[model samples]
Target: MDIVVFFVASGCAIASAIAVVAQKNPFVSALALLANLASLAALMLLLEAQFVAAAQIIVYAGAVMVMFLFVIAYVGPRGEIGGGVRKPWLVALSVFAALLIAVEVIVVVFGASLGAVASVDTDYGSPAAIGKALVTDYLLAFEVVSVILFMAAVAGVVFGTGGRPVRLSTEQVLAKEGESAVARRREASRAALDAARDSTTGESAR
Candidate 1:
């Protein structure tokens, strides 16, 4: 049953991965990626890495996929690729990349003599152990990743606004509306006063 489950997850993972690349619609492709992540998490669970599986589901499938979907929605159809004319250089580059991946897969499967999988302890994927490793051994790498993520967020904001700082705030918008209303009221009063003055002069002349 475990073997069957593993195979099923593996197949789903592969199929969803292909669909992620194949789908022209950005939203559909994001859904495919979510499925792929879900299947990968299943595979991780089968390997007895419960914490890793949970993290995979929560982090990649939950947070990352949600972010991707939000971006796709925010960007709308304009963010979709493959809708415009394909460039020759892009096509060539894609073909070359596919061929390179195929070669690497063939070499790994047929040429390389991979060793047996190593065994791990029961707590290998536990949160405590992982946290300890992160703070102790991988502390520098973890901090670096945080900094990179922060920079990425800053860059995203910069590019999202077309390199311009945010100019309008809630207070600014309200102030502008108030000024417009005041100006409109002043104009109305002036018009009313002019009409009253003209009527009084016409009566006096008569």
Candidate 2:
């Protein structure tokens, strides 16, 4: 059963990851990534790491993927197929390096005697234990992440409002005023010409 679960989870993860890269549409790619993340969470659950699996689903597959979708919706759909692929060599090198790392991880896992590893106690799931660890070990890092999230939210609001500039430089202000004055003068000249033409037509008729 364990072997079957592992194989099924692994296949799902790999298939979804491939779909994410292969899909041309950004929304499809995002959905594929979400599937990959969910499959990963399942794999973690199979490994008996329930806490980590829940965190993965909630934080990454839920929140982060939703955020990505929101951004995609805000940006609207792509109109053009992107330019030709560039730097194929760099991409190949990256894939090669990732394969090498995967090989190393597999070798280390299988080569090491599984019996030598200490058994993990499942007591780490307690709320008190988690709170203590977060407060004692990761408090500063957690606070920093919160601060960053707050800053990002504030920046999104400020930049997303889509308004005209509140402050203009002297040259910009002068240029705008000059353009307005020129437009007004042109309108006045056009009005005067129309009035003169009308008067001339009336005199000729008389």
Candidate 3:
């Protein structure tokens, strides 16, 4: 049953991940990413890393996906973006370089004859156990991550406000009104002069 579940979840995750890249619409891609994350969480649950699974679902699939949806809606998929390194060859080269680095890292970490990874405790995946390690062993990294996330949230808020119409100050409003009034007065004066000239010409002709 566990094997069956793992295979199913793994397949779903892989499929969703591919769909995330395949979908042209960013919102649809985000939805695919959400599915991928959920499947990964399910796989984590099967591995007995319950806390990690919960965090994946709550933090990534829930919070991050919601933020992605909001940003996608705000920016809109149809918005035109100009000026970038848009060449297909450049993008393909970048992707290839990234894949190569990833492969190297994976090989170094997993293919090593003598692994440097310490074996975790049986209760490592438990909330209490993970929390203790987070506060004690990985405290600095955890705090740094928290700070980064806070900054990202602030950036998101700023970006969200970018599309909104800014309110004009009272002084700016007054200035605009003054300018329009002056233009209107100039227009009236021009019309009066034209009308008077026509009347004088008519009298002179008589």
List per-candidate RMSD values in Å: 10.6, 9.5, 10.4
Ranked by lDDT, the better of candidates 2 and 3 is 3
User: For residues 99-180, could you state the per-residue lDDT of candidate 1 as single tens digits?
Assistant: 9999999988988777787899888878888889999999999999999999999998887879566677646766877767
Cα TM-score per model: 0.69, 0.66, 0.67
Candidate 2 yields a Cα-based lDDT of 0.83
Model 1: residues with Cα > 4 Å off, grouped in runs: 84-93, 163-206
lDDT of 2 by residue, 28-126 (tens): 889999889988988988766677788889999879889999987766666126624659898899999999999999999999887854566776544
Model 3 alpha-carbon drift over 4 Å, by segment: 79-88, 98-122, 158-206
Question: Against the true structure, whose TM-score is highest?
Answer: 1
Return the TM-score for candidate 1, rounded to 2 decimals. 0.69
The segments of candidate 2 whose C-alpha lies over 4 angstroms from its true place after superposition are: 87-91, 113-117, 126-128, 158-206
Candidates 1 and 2 compared by TM-score, better number: 1
Model 2, residue pairs in steric clash: none
